[model samples]
Target: MDKVYDHRKYEQKIYSLWEKNGAFTPKVDKSKNPFTIIMPPPNANDPLHVGHAREVATQDILIRYHRMKGNSTLWLPGSDHAGIETQYVFEKKLREKGKSRSDYDRDTLYNMIWDYVKDNTGVMEKQLRQLGASCDWSRFKFTLDEKIIKIVYKTFKKLYYDGLIYRGERIVNYCPLCGTSFSQLEVNYIEKEDELYYLDYETLTIATTRPETIFADVAIAVNPKDNKYKKLVGKAAKIPLINREVPIITDRLVDLNFGTGALKVTPGHDPVDFEIGEKHIPSIISVIDMEGKMINTPEKYISMKASVAREEVVKDLEEKGYIKKRERLHHSVGVCYKHKTPIEPIVSKQWFIKVKPLAEISKAALKKGEVKIVAKKYDKIAHHWLNNLKDWNISRQIVWGIRIPAWRCDKCLEWTITDGVVPKNCVSCGHEKLIQDPDTFDTWFSSGQWPYATLLAQSRISNFQFPISKNDKAKFEDFDYFYPTSVMNPAYDILPFWVIRMIMLGLYATTRVPFKIVLLHGLVRDRFGVKISKSKGNVINPIEMINKYGADSLRMASIWGSLVENDSSLSEDNIRGQRNFANKIWNAARFIFLESVAKRGGYSKAPTTKNSYDLKIIKQLRVTTKKVTRLLEKYRLNEAAETLYDFFWNQFANDYLEKTKSRRKDAQKILDFVLQESLKLLHPFMPFVTEAIWQESKNRFNNTTLISSSWPK
Candidate 1:
């Protein structure tokens, strides 16, 4: 704790000193181009998980690298107002006090949440800072911040007035427990063993896992070419519960070999059914309600929840001559992330954005290479999403998000929409009382506009960010410099959601792609390829890792674990090895400093610009630096980190420093260059420790600080 490579003492001292001295601030100029990355802010509800830490560390490395390269860099830090997650956390807290979110009024509850979020945000910020993130903390912006909210409103109004936004009845992934509809991406599908209930539809017997949905079944479908069910085509089968006659249809959409060679079309319940409804059976009645239970399916199964109805319907089917047999089958069902409840796609009147036009623009941009995907592998993924893009449903029936600004007029019954301040009276009706729409914008609605909104705080734009001219009116100097960002480093899971949306928004607003490169990272799983989870008792606590091995060590382990493009696993042993690497750097720096400190405290000789020793290290440094930089440019973060680790730990610290220690008389020059170069290289990944030793070394050749030192060009 006193000295001697005490990680806690040095890390704390170094961070406090650097922050106080504004070490993370990158010099900005209208003339010099800037490097920028908008961080994928996590909701401040939970503690910083390992996955979150990896992203932060990766972003930090990019930002710091750019900063050292003399490019003005800004890592915009912020948090999303995660409606469901934050609401759940608050609800849990309130429940502990014997209350519910519904118990409080919306405004009062919102105020309470605002306080809660601010407090939670502080905690996360501290954790990120402790991890040595070089983000410009002074420029941090939250999604709920007044400025961001205004941007959201402005975006909504622009999109609405342009006819790209509308309200209509559509099927959405619905979770009954949460009483809300989820976006497609929010739904998780899990394969489970379910019962395949055989039901005799007159002469044709069909199998179904969800016997409850049999009441909602519009038509029993068989493959057109299936000779077995050829005679059953055009025949009507009476449903078990309501006894409503449904025609047995011949359609190629049905798989002849799947589930007794027959399929049921429940347009109101499933996506596939909805598609079939659009094409073949539009007149079919929907018997299932929003809660996934039988609504108008008759008295026996009506009003029961879907889960309860599953059992009841099957029992009745067995007793009433409808059941033929039941067999076990493996099937995939969507589940909500929070509640783990099965997600049912139910028809609902929600707002949607006409995304085809936007998607076309995005597709064109990528086709033109205006928006370059980092990994190149993402090109296929991007193409898949854009080519098969569907209209985006931007509305959510949640209380804790940006409220939809459309309002229905009492007199005219027509909706008048505005993103500006709510009108006291409806524009059409002149009614004194106007009701604000209760629906909240989907989380992605706000997220989609991040690239533009964060830059210009506007939705629509008429100009690009390049070729700076006096006549141009783009707001931020940084935006102009960094617009059409070099890369967008993010996870591949969001290719359809956030990544593609950003590209589309960029094309719509700026007539260009948001970023030229996109670095994709894989998920961090456990050693055995199983995902880390608290319930499974296999989750690694990042906080505990930090306390034991220090933040730098944990980050290094993350780098090491990121061996490939897809899912990678981390082990405690690997983290400890990273800690050892940090200790090695510290010990080497201490050794050099001790010799210099003992020699009556005078300046040591600087490394000759042309010496073989200097050239060798410099050449190696250049090769290492260039290789790592290129890798990062390509969004190969793990590869880049690996390169740095090998060079710094293996070559510089291990080989060069050991030799330099023996030649103590001329060691001053070699030591200075090695320390400076190593610090410059390691600054991105291990900021605190490097800067701590850089300051303590006392062999100052230049007046420039470690944080602002130029990267080896």
Candidate 2:
């Protein structure tokens, strides 16, 4: 029984052999078309979690299935230098040693980070390797690598030169801990219980969930179409805390049935207020600072944090003549995605990408059938975000990221941007004194260029051989060959932020859709449908699972728990079932190997008149291969894995294995065929175990390793 399938010893040995043999490299025959996928790069500071494992398994299955179908497949592998997250990690590490990031200069700290990554990156890579990722690791790219950063800067300059990127002061999300501005997608909406303060509006009353924003209110808005508040328009109302009189304006954006018909417009704090402020020029009052504190407000509230100011404002409103009544309310509040803290929309000068131009191209691409979404139901959601998309905020006030290439000369105060960097002398005044933009490009700005930036390294190394370069024509060999990649597989959460922006930038740069198909996987949530978060202590560590059971076992478990189109839970019971299934395959392989060796190559001829057992097994093999093939083509990897698992364990190992044990010759043929086909189907999911067993018995079967071998015909 190979001593109960020694997974630990065999998993590494087998994987190393596969790597040595170049099994992951595609067979580059011009006759066969290439199938490619750029993996969603994960932050390297942490190990792979259950959520990440599921995504990797899905992609691996697709790549392996396509390879078996004789298509040249390339599953490009890489990691991201997650700017904020990684910076936080290193800072924490420094803090533990009683030092801060400021102790070292940018270059010194950056070198330390690179050194840390060099030391720890192999840990996660080895974990992924154990899961049997058939990624061409030799072609791996890092987002912060010199080549990738150059490509990122080049893309940024192109957009700036084309006037698509601009800087302006606007209300944006501010994270107190990170001390940086976040994009709209970087904020997650959560329901919170709060009080709706109904304040006196002349004779009537206006209820508000955020009474603190009243300090910054520029105008009170009522729906233009609502006759109930039509008479209240063009009137003046005194703010409760600050006795400032703001004119009441009517607009259609207000929902008459929601809370009170009168809505306070805090032009410098709220998005809707910004829009209203633009329509009707009103007195601007910015009560909040970048640190989310009241900068300039009523006397008692000056220099207070936003939350503290809320309490003071509420109490003052209740004591003053403006407070009519209050009611408990539950509503969605936007919070920073990383720290889960409420985001403050404080106005600040930042770079933004005008989304309308890119959005039109994205919509046209989908409408013209250039981009396709799997499952089809997501099309409406995609369209809704695309149609109503606002301009993307693309700048961050942080130290550790790609610095803005544009510079401002102090002498002439003229903004200048060269292809790579601004010249030492100012173009206007011939002054050598120039200051680089203090802000960094947003993280998404770099990630948006991932699909093309990956090729930048190859482009540079190959001396601009790739078709994505400035001088290279789109009709060039490489672009025509791999320009429109086969598919983009990512989580559904990135639909608005990353996916849509990539579609727009890819079209602008390559003049084509980045990939032809988008495979959106649902989140790996808990059993109750709540996301497994680190704060909630519900996060499952993949490294712990790998230590207990081998990575192949953990990977198979993830595949089993995953549903093709819906969020699924990673339960312990599910993983145990997967372990048992792996054992079943191992035991069956051992039994077949012993029998065939004993009979000195047992079955040479294919059996014609088969028993019910043989027919049932053959029929299952045929049906399973066909189903898995179709499912893989459709990117239903979880379904494909499920189909293979059930057939291999239930029908073959349980019923068929016991039934055909006695009939040596006929049984061996049936077992060989079923086992071979099952391995082919399961190879992508559990490459280590499958290849280990296949290589051990290669003399009696096929010559190639399971990794590179063609699928069952």
Candidate 3:
């Protein structure tokens, strides 16, 4: 064995060997129970950061451990076709080339993005290998793959025909910059300090944060219980800048304590106002276009950006005595998750899934413990979100995803949603002239079916062809065996964005939970506990970390440094400490090989007389093995890692190895057994170093490889 364990020298070589030998492919042994995990597919739009590294490491630990335990294990890998994010990245590249998506037609732009993502997917898969993700490469999937897209289309068609999906004009979180609509879960809310404008309407003062949306206001709202506005409930008020007559109505939704005790109702621009307008008001006005530019307003304000229009409107209102007062206030505002631009609530015709019924089933399942959430605290959060669920907006104005199957008749304007292919005529009116819906399904809409779709794709029953018969039960041997996956490990920040949707859709499609266990991990932050982001210039590249400190060392540091449920901050010093731990293991193994075995040529038999120290060490090893197994079973990975580190470094290397130096033969026998067993226990956490040492000492073991070796008993 070499004096030092260098991970860079062995990681790629060992990973390639494992891949070549099909070590990651699951063996369908009917005797042993099956264990499966569907990887939370990463976005193929960019290189992975440290968070992805940690996630892959944790998942690989579980996978390798289960495989060694003689279970038919599978870790399926894939990547997401992140609609808005991919478009954003490609658009940036286009700007560098002095062009944009508009430079080509829809089909051309879609194909361009597909090619861009294909290249990026290769880069991401290579990175996953570098991080030692032992996912079955043969079963790798892409969200936009023909087979997966077919499954997505089938799910959409099923939901539409079942009356769970509808198309209507409703307020949606619209990212003007991306020219798309997002579900509420996709918007990130940030608090900002801005001026609250108090505008003078005909007889009442209305307060609003977005003065630019005044033209869309259909009414002025006051609390029915507030005495200050009791007499003005049934009156009409003229809008400030637009001079539009809007009714003054009493609504319990109004917060009387909030500025001026009156609210401007802009149904086309605010979610709460839309609900109120839908109930009481007849007309809905939309003053802003999909591009975030002013529209359906005066020519002076037309075509101006919302922020620019805000300034112009505010200035004009003050000069015309329509601005009664202005106060500084801090309020939370929704923004696009990708571009960070303020999200505009726009009323548009979009497809929506009625989520209330689905949420009820998921909530009941949680209470029944059909799906167990780790760290129990998140159960309340999941429950609350489901209890107050709103209809999910699952349509986006993008071209690089599964186009909605619905089509409209060009002559009669009636719509028809077919199973897969475009119909010859509309279902409502037999008009041959038809146009397909120009929008695609939201990214999450397709990803929500990831667990089922990926498994269905693996089945022989699915031929990657759309319009699958509704009566045909989508089932195969693999789907039946791994339908309810054993575990689902995902970042906690995406609890609502991805997790809940997966559970709901999984149950809806398969009549079973997506996974039995939901292990939620936290964000990967910097040393200061601040989240790592490219904009902050604090993002840690996992590849750079691997290059500097070996992949095994980096994995050890990530596991030992923090618990699964808590945010962990990475530092060079922490990783360096783990590297030193790796060195200790290497040196100890080298000492056992050089001083004991090599000096005396190999031993033919086990030590006949067991000394007191030998018995003591064996007892400690048994206890440690049992403890580590229990910890791993309970998903207490950090505790398991720390326990192994202490037992190996402090107990075995420090105390036992020192005592056995004088007794070479006995030392060889005992150290060989202890080291081999220790390697098995630690292999899951630090696979490369352990595997390299195991390979060097392969003659002492019966197993062909450490990864396929039996778990420590």
Task: Name the best candidate (by TM-score).
Answer: 3
- Candidate order by TM-score, decreasing, is 3, 2, 1
What residue pairs clash in candidate 3, if any at all? Answer: none
How do the residues 1-713 of candidate 3 rate in per-residue lDDT, one tens digit apiece? 87778888888999988888789999656688889999999998678888888898889999999999999999999999988888888998999999987789999999899988887788899999998899998888889988888788778877887899999999999988788999988889999999998889978887888899999888999988999888888889999877778889988998888998898988999999999898899589998989999998889999999899999999999999998888999999899988888999999999999998789889988989999998878888888789887999999998888899888988889778865677998788798988899899888888888987887887666443322334444345566677689988899988898889999988887778889999998888888988888878887778888898888877877776677878888877778889899889999988877743542322323344559888888889889999999999998898999999999999999999999978877567778888888988999999888888877774665466789888878
- Candidate 1 versus truth, CA RMSD in Å, comes to 3.8
Screening candidate 2 with a backbone cut-off below 3 angstroms (N, C-alpha, C), the clashing residue pairs are: none
Scored by lDDT, model 2 comes in at 0.77
Local distance difference test values of all predictions, in order:
0.74, 0.77, 0.86
Question: Which candidate achieves the best lDDT against the true structure?
Answer: 3
- The alpha-carbon lDDT assigned to residue 402 of candidate 2 equals 77
- What does candidate 1's lDDT look like per residue over 539-643, in tens digits? 887778888888888887776645435777877887888888888878877776665434332223334665566567767877887898788666567788788
Candidate 1 runs further than 4 Å off: 1-3, 222-235, 248-252, 260-262, 280-286, 291-293, 424-433, 457-472, 476-478, 561-564, 595-606, 609-626, 648-662
Cα lDDT tens digits for candidate 2, 634-673: 7667787888878888888888888876786767767786
